[model samples]
Target chain A: MAQPLKFYFDFLNQSSRALYIFLEASKIPFEAIPISMLKGEHLTGEFRDKVNRFRKLPAITDHGYQLSENVAIFRHLAREKLVPEHWYPRRQLGRSRIDEYLAWQQTNMDVACTDYFQQKWLVPYLQKTRPAENAVNVAGKQLEHTLNDFEQLFLNSRKFMMGDNISFADLSAICEIDQPKSIGYNAFQNRNKLARWYEAVRDELGPYYKDVHGEFEAKLKQSGSSNQGVAQALKQ
Target chain B: MAQPLKFYFDFLNQSSRALYIFLEASKIPFEAIPISMLKGEHLTGEFRDKVNRFRKLPAITDHGYQLSENVAIFRHLAREKLVPEHWYPRRQLGRSRIDEYLAWQQTNMDVACTDYFQQKWLVPYLQKTRPAENAVNVAGKQLEHTLNDFEQLFLNSRKFMMGDNISFADLSAICEIDQPKSIGYNAFQNRNKLARWYEAVRDELGPYYKDVHGEFEAKLKQSGSSNQGVAQALKQ
Candidate 1:
């Protein structure tokens, strides 16, 4: 029998969540392995050599082939699995729209969310230091700007990013947007368009939704007190 | 009769340079339209509303279909043109490596190069102020670190980023590295492995290489103290 593909991720990461959900949705048999950023497991030389040299998450190794970068992972898997056109889009134009979303989000929502993540929660948890008021303010404003762009520039009133269809773009954006929830601020709270789109994404994801994101969120909640919380979660 | 695709780019942007070269190499018929960043052409209502909502490039329009982001543009073109498998591998693993290179560069060489571009040239050109010594030093160091990673982690003496045959990854990286040349620096000057690989990429691009890049290099040379030079080139 063929070896089950290995997925290495930490729930603290939005990209990892996106990939986790995508792999489960694709129905390809695989074992999901959580690498703890809290433990700095990803910083190990062995992980660098054997896994991703970039030492980033949402990466996979299948039958000895190692790959990293969430967008690449999504594209590779979508093409390889030959999933429905609605899922990833088969025609050149349709797929290009998905591509625009994936790439655009990098400097937009992803940057804002990560900055906000480090400021509002991760720094306090990991560094045991309070996030500076100025830093927090800056990050929050940046995130707001990004969220506005997400709704105005990309998500809009559409049920999905590529319209009516829940493609890889929808999965990727929702994962990034959900990052701000750690601060008890929901990006979808005021934006009806985005809120509706988020619900649609959750529905399309079905039962696989929680497994991909829930464990990570659970781990994040416990991470504040000690690194032990993350370590313990990894073991389970 | 079918309408030929429109390729929108500004040579000042490295990703645009990559797509310009790739489109030519793919043997697809296209009308290359240059958008002037210095003149704020990309910020205009018509460009933003019609071309790309994100208002970044290199974007494309085929008949009525519109798209933005170079990676998507390259992937879509490669698939639609049915280019040789070596240009864009048919198998998942082969394509994943290429994907890894393309995506890895985003956080790696791409970031560093863009920072360097802003510090060494763009800021100085647009702002009419000399780059801060401290800022330039920091940006240059970041670029050096990224180049080292590009060589050790990805390139490693391979004839191409995906090994041997050229792919979109090679085009993307070379275009980015070329940005430093506007400031009179060659990234490959000290790296033997990278220099050879760069030459191999240029060779593979064939006669099409100069047309995509040469015009941009020429434009950069004229943009220094005289916006008139750029205007003259545009008029031509």
Candidate 2:
């Protein structure tokens, strides 16, 4: 008998949450092995032997094959039709649009938003020191630029990045964008279309969203501290 | 009749060189349309409307399907055996390794090497004021770190990134690393193994490498400037 497909994830991570939501929504069977980065479990030697050079979480192993990186995993899963086919279209132009979004997001949304999360929550918590206002301002500016681009290019004409249906692109975006809200930015407050789209994504994700993201949100609130809380607590 | 596969390329680009070489070697017919970034051809309204939001070059159009980004195009073309089937293995581990290299390279080698190329060659030609030395130093450090990681992780044991055979991984690496050398860095001088691999890549590519890259190199030399030479020489 083949080993059950296993996903190594930490609920705290937005990337992992996106994949977890994806798998749950599609009703794919996989055992979840939680490797909490917050607890420094991911850096252990035993974990290192399993994952090798990657210090990041949210890896997947199936039939003894290990894979990392969210977009690649998302692509592999998307190929399995756990998500909408239009999420990674087979045609040239359609596929390129998806590819463009994936590539662009790494430097744009992923980097900027992650930086903001770290600055707003993680930095003050871990360092027990307030980050320079300029650092926070820089991250805020980057977030604004990315959000503006997302609105003008992606959310403007279509219901989703690719088209009318929800996609991994939308899921990926929502996960990162929502990070700010958890830390207190309220990204969807002023943007009506973005807010509507977020609701649609949450609706489509259904119970899967509740199961994975709900638990994580509970923990986040329980901590009563943003990344800063965790950081500051560690110092104490 | 279907429109012949049309490639918008500047041979100086690693991704374009890889694609052009692959197409030529495989005897897949493609029309090469040079879009010189140095001459600002890529920023033109005509190019923008046609290619859509992407500002980058090395885009391809096949029967009305337009695509940009090398990895996306490489994946599409590699499917047709312009390269090896194992270049993007369908299995989880094999595909992940390839995907890892592809994903890792974008922000790593691709961005770093491109910055180096621009600073070494393009900035002087294109920008009125040269970029600061510290900026150049930072870019150089990034390139070195990426190369070191490539050597330590991928190249240490395997003849290729996926092991024992050429794949798109080699193609992608060769293209970017070749950029610094073209601009007079002699990047492979101290790196004999990497040099040998590059030679092998060139040999594997055969006449196809010469036809596409050779033509572009000749044009670059003849013009002494970058895009100005290409634009002046090639009308359409």
Candidate 3:
């Protein structure tokens, strides 16, 4: 038997949740090794040595071979047929679009949404303190700009970013967008196409979303965090 | 005869320069289409529709096939043997490491460095006014952190990021580091290993760097920008 693939990530990370949903939806057998960034577990020397010395989470150790980066992991998993063939695109232009989305999202949507979550939810709820008001406002502005860009570039014409079929680009964007919703931002609620796409993603992921997101909600509730609206629904 | 490959970019961009240098060094036939971000060329509808409908640059059109993202372009070019075999590892693990570096750099080093360049140089220079002194100072601090991480994670152990061979990671990094140097920031000067590695990259590219960089520097000077030291050097 192949040594079990081990995924290392915190439950709260949007990228980690995206990967988690992918694995769960694919029905891949894997062991979860949670590395709590909040608890400083990733900073430990042992974890550093065993995993990437850089101490970045959302890494994976597959059959003793360690790999990092969501794009690489997604590509490996997709290559193994965990994702639909259309998701990874064999055509050069299609593949380039996927690469373009992935590259653009890292600094654009991902960073903006992550900053929003860190300020509005994580820092206040997890760290038990409020971030500076200006920081929060800046994050909100960034999030708005990112969503507008997404609306213009992605949701305008195609049913998905690439086409009618949902790809990793959709998955990546949906997970990050979900962050603000969990904090009661509701930015996507008014956007019809985006909202429809989110539902489709949730339906496809199904119980897997419950498993990854369910546990995350429980943690947030137990901490008595104010950002519990999304979590409360997940419990049911 | 094949229509020459059309490369679109702001020549001052490090990632763009890397591709330009690679194509030049390999003696690949291509036409340079400069996208002057300083003049808002990238945001224009004509450029957006042709290269990337999403309004991103550093894109390429080859045989009417349009593509974006530096990694995809690099891979495409490398597949054509414009890059050494070792630049993109063929074996599974080796290739994954390259992917890891490529992916991580986008979010970490690349973003950090670009942010610094924008805040420190571009915004003040192009806008023809200085930003807040505190903002520039903060950007400088963040850049220092990023450089320190680069030295620790990438430069410490291996001859290259992957070990014992020059790869695209080195090329990517050298281009970015060269930016600050162009503007009179000599972060690599005192760092012996980094300096040596940069020299190797410079030697590898040779006169190709001169042609692309020489034109880029001239354009910057012609723009009458007082903030760019690199442009000043080229003018002299």
The better-scoring model by lDDT among 2 and 3 is 3
Each prediction's DockQ against the real complex: 0.63, 0.43, 0.60
Model 2 quality (TM-score): 0.85
Q: Candidate 2 or 3, higher TM-score?
A: 3
The model with the greatest TM-score is 1
Residue A118 accuracy (lDDT) in model 2:
79
Give the Å shift of residue B20 in candidate 2.
Answer: 2.3
Q: Which numbered prediction scores highest in DockQ against the true structure?
A: 1
Give the alpha carbon lDDT tens digit for every residue of B1-236 in model 1. 54468888988899988887776666678888889988988888998999877677778887757787787788778766656677677654678788878778776778899998787777767766666567778988998888888888877656777766777777788888888755666676688888888888888887777786788777777786464422332332
Which of 1 and 2 is ahead in TM-score? Answer: 1
Model 3 alpha-carbon drift over 4 Å, by segment: A1-4, A78-84, A130-134, A156-159, A225-236, B1-4, B26-28, B76-84, B129-134, B156-158, B220-236
Q: Give the per-residue lDDT of model 2 (tens digit) for A42-109.
A: 89998767763566677887666667778777776666545556556665356656776777777678
Better of 1 and 3 by DockQ: 1
Q: Candidate 2: lDDT over CA atoms?
A: 0.71
For residues A102-143, write the lDDT of model 1, one tens digit per residue. 877876778899998777777766766665668878998998
Q: Which stretches of candidate 2 lie over 4 Å from their true place?
A: A1-3, A78-96, A222-236, B1-4, B78-87, B91-93, B128-131, B189-192, B215-236
Q: Per-residue lDDT for B1-236 in model 3, tens only?
A: 65458899888788898888777766678888888887788898888787777666688888777777788788677654455577777665666777777887887777777777676567767666654468767876777777777776667545566777767777788787766556556676457777766777777667877777787667656653565542443333
iRMSD for every model: 1.3, 2.0, 1.9
